[model samples]
Target: MTFPSPKAEAPAQRFQEATAAARTALEQLVAQANEAGWGTEEISVALLEAARFLNEANRKDPDPADDPAISDTPAKEQIGHGELYD
Candidate 1:
């Protein structure tokens, strides 16, 4: 008798793939909704929630080809919050 070695089930991989697909769908939906002149607050909030969900699911940033929505702006910004209180 041979015991099966420990390994991830096929369903686990499928689930991860499904999660990634959902994230891609969401990103495209958000872009379309935004372009269609959907409410700013609604679109912004939805995108934020989607990002949180993907992060929780352990999804990495989409590939360049897959990420048409990638930001073009520089990452760093000088802090301009009011003068420090003495």
Candidate 2:
């Protein structure tokens, strides 16, 4: 394994610390929102949008059209009955 240089190390550590602090801040904000009566649906949708934003920001590949790893096959759907019926 390779170690980061002295100059690069501080910035990397700072980034790591910032992300950790942000996670705690987000948790507290979500809890406050919940206590302030934001419904599950609203909170969930907001979080989902945040996730999509993060994915878009960090994605390396903008297109997967020619990517061989992606399957062209149609998805197989599973039908389920109630627990008692099953």
Kindly report which residue stretches of model 1 are placed more than 4 angstroms away from their true locations once superposed: 1-9, 40-86
lDDT per residue as tens, model 2, 1-86: 22233333588887876676666666776787899999757886898799898788669666755565423432332124332223
RMSD of each: 15.1, 12.9
Task: Report how far off residue 67 is in candidate 1 (Å).
Answer: 40
- Cα error, candidate 1, residue 35 (Å): 0.4
Q: Compared to the true structure, candidate 2 yields what TM-score?
A: 0.38
Estimated TM-score for each candidate: 0.37, 0.38
- The per-candidate count of clashes, in order, stands at 0, 0
* CA lDDT scores, all candidates in order: 0.63, 0.64
lDDT of 1 by residue, 9-72 (tens): 6988767766766676677777789899997679879878977987865655545456544244
